[model samples]
Target chain A: MSDLDLLKYTCGRTDLSLICDLIDPGSSVLDLGCGDGLFLRYLKERKNVRSLGLEISAEKIASCIANGVPVIQGDLDSRMEFAADGDFDYVILSRTLQEVRHPENLLDEIVRVGKQAIVSFINFGYFEYRFELFFCGRMPRGRHLPYEWFNTPNIHLGTLTDFHTLCRERHIRIVSAEPLGRIHGILPKWCWPNLFAHSCVFVLEKEK
Target chain B: MLLIEPQNYDFGPGEENALELDCRKKLYEVTLRYETCGKLNADRSNAVLIEHALSGDAHVTGYHTPEDRKPGWWAEMVGPGKAIDTDRYFVICSNILGGCSGSTGPRSIDPATGKPYNMNFPVITIADMVRAQKRLIDHLGISKLLAVVGGSMGGMQVLQWMIDYPDSVAAAVPIATTAQNSAQNIAFNWVGREAIISDPKFDGGNYDPENPPGKGLSTARMLAHITYLSDETMGRKFGRNLQENDHYAFDFRRDFAVESYLQHQGRRFVERFDANSYCYITRAIDYFDLADRTNGDLAAAFHSAKGKFLVVSFSSDWLFPTKQARALVKALLANHLETNFCEIQSGYGHDAFLLEIDTLGAMVGAFLANTLNEVSSGKQRGAQS
Candidate 1:
């Protein structure tokens, strides 16, 4: 079965392997916003990726240890001063975009640390979200976007289109991009990709 | 269970293996007491060095004897299945050169005079202590170490190990220690030192063989104990509660529970520890500043470090606070080293490294285990290439 087909049937978001597939075997990787470090271990097992993770909380760090993951306790918003430029083959910011304090600075740092990057985020401009705002006159709430407005970790939520614009303005190239969730591949051309995709993933590299 | 007596590595007879000090002197004929748990592997790559803090002896785990009910200092966390599991790694803990516990120190007899070195013992520094540990590591026939784990002064030694022998260690765990002792730290040491020297019986580090400086030594221990604990922790354990009575005693006797506790700690410490050794070790710790060698360039110290680093700090450890760990982390990062830092949520002050067994063990175990896995895999990859 296709990756999307398998995800559609699965109960939880247990599919960072889709991003793991993008990494070359035996390459180095760094995962920012690594919670519990399961994705890091997944990369290690499947891709032979010599990976490390950066997490902030002590509880998460303890859990990372419990799982035997080599994770560092640190914040992405802080200068990742330890990581040198082009240190890793890929730096994955999976599903952690809106949670960042500064998306622009974070993307810059990702490109600085990794030769390439894989970014995944919830698309606030999705059709379901817009429909909720337009018809029900309330903020969107769905399977992926689970938290209330006040309690949401997605402080800087934005659309996939908005991300594309930011990348263009900052001279970073989106090497590849994909839409995700229930009806992503079923949608046709000219059907507004940003407004329909529930979430988005993109491979990014520096222009210069 | 019981543990074997710690084996001694005798340098023997008048400065034969003289160790140079940071203060521009050399210690003549020093001996180090060390104990090993777990057998060394065929490849000898599984050796892990455990450095002890001030007042800690060579025994890190297991009991001295069946009659001695208390196990070694870190027994709770360094056993067969413990965090620093003895079954997998060859663990070695040594009494530092300047330490009195079976190691050549102020208490050791001077070969020339046939009397205790006492005040005549050359001043030693933290770097000197690490150098002595290195000598012990060499004597054991291990070319490299998998990791060096320590807390406080022991932690200071770990940092020195990383800097001093950059390529020798594979990884390091420096818990509850700083690259440089703060002014406040020095001040606390000063107070502790003053208490010892002020006693009339101290007699400039020489003393009556029978009387010694028991009062002074205990008072010094009492002073040092306060710095090891946080105000909140002290309050929780003792507060302003009176000893055996609700009413305050107006006399000079130990009235408050805290006062009694401090006195008890002081009394117990003198029985096991040497007063002159206390003076020397504290001096050594105060002199420790890794950045000094590189003219205040902290990153330069770790520039040649080949080891992955794990730096841990406790929340309430104001003695070696989280900020100090962060500063050290920044330096390690500046050198492009693989370093992980965790400021654990705790309220036990500097003593948390010794008390918080579960968290400390798990993190050290995982970090060391993962390091071994990665190193072996890298070796295999190299062979394939």
Candidate 2:
């Protein structure tokens, strides 16, 4: 099945729709770590956007080409020298922030290459994870953070507040921050998002 | 199965029509050998040019006759319903300018002397080859080719086509190639040239046509053929197996199957290939540094190009490694060109461009379809504007 069709079946499972909604129609997009190019393909089909992807896997790059999404095979952690300043309207780093070696350096690169950046990650300070770690004295295991501490790809995991602080420290303005709790869907306005939200999406731009 | 005939196109008896080579000499009475498959559509935007590699020829796909033992070099990717799909696009493959396959090369009779040009043939570059091809395309009334595709040396030509005539090409696929011939590659070419020049019978490239430098040319071909295959494939195919005996022949005879296999390749190459042509062609390849004209800025070299690109490499192709392809892709990306790159998983080395048919076919086929769609839609938008 096409990635659009697949997205329809699993629309409620993740923040792909949230990220897609944030991007304006007909905007140019650069998706980092765009696995199988599904999200870029989604942008191309639904929003009629000019989309490209940077992926390290040859297999995934081939899949992107086969699906008619322009992509360059490259490591996300390496210097993205190929991308010119403000070449893309949106540079989406969905669920790939924590996996990168240096999230701060990558965020700087994304904002430099794109006018706006959309970052999504699993919030580490969710109340259930806090309770588990507090009571059991073990590396927290939740739906998103499934792997053991020794094997998990998420090396630099952080909470929603941590992301806000990083943006503040880096002189980046947060355009919007959406916190979605798995149990209650959109987190209640009364609830503290850092403690209650399961995952979060942040739209950021570099301060002038 | 289609039976195709190779066609000859000639240009230049006049000084104005003569092609000026990179070596600062004019070449006259040039001939380009070419073959075409499928019909050119009314709009003529469906034409695809296929450039041949160092050892390849004009015949790209289809049989010359019913009794022919084999098809063209890229038959697996250019037939009906194949990756290039001759059924859908009008495909053209031409023998390069400095090639032996009926093209005007060192082997062709010199117009002035009425003998083989031999060493007298002005050294040509990849750009010169593309310039000759431009004449043929003009003669065929194709204003712009839908795509230009090639592998190895052929890929160099494809890059030249994109850069030289940016508006004339809609898309390009350069596979298993590098923009600049690496130093190691130049060393390999130098050794091959030395092999041909040092032969006793070569006699400064004036050897009798009937008694050419067979041994030296064969040895050069053997060395090159080794570069085209991976150690994994070599081990899988030969694996130290004896050619005819269970025990090793301690003397310098062909004992290993790999030795005999290389011997067969060399012998077969010497029969159809010209030693002088090899020298000129390999020299052309060695001189192919795309960034030389742009002050070593690779991206600036493609500043005017406006074509979609698909750059492919094989994982095991050390001769033109994936890193070189990556560098080329990085330059294209820096230009903000519509570029797609993939290093295919294969154990066949540089020859994987020809051998890895299924995966390569699927990718090319889809990319071609996408390009056609985008280009046509763009034309429609232009029309409305």
Listed per candidate, the RMSD to the true structure in angstroms reads: 3.9, 3.0
Structure candidate 2, residue pairs in collision: none
| Candidate 1 segments exceeding 4 Å error | A1-28, A42-50, A63-69, A77-90, A100-118, A133-138, A148-151, A161-177, A184-190, A202-208, B12-16, B372-385
Provide a comma-separated list of chain B TM-scores, one per candidate: 0.96, 0.98
Local distance difference test, each candidate: 0.83, 0.89
Docking class of 1: acceptable
> Model 1: per-residue lDDT, tens digit, B153-180?
9999999998888767888999999999
Candidate 2: Cα lDDT at A103: 91
For residues A62-157, could you state the per-residue lDDT of candidate 2 as single tens digits? 688877789887777877777778989999998889898999999899899999999887899999899989999988998888899999999998
- Which candidate ranks first by TM-score, i.e. highest? 2
Docking class of 2: medium
Minimum summed lDDT over a 10-residue window in model 1 chain B is located at B376-385
Q: Cα miss at A37, model 1 (Å)?
A: 2.4
lDDT tens digits, residue span B155-205, model 2: 999999989998888999999999999998998899998999999999999
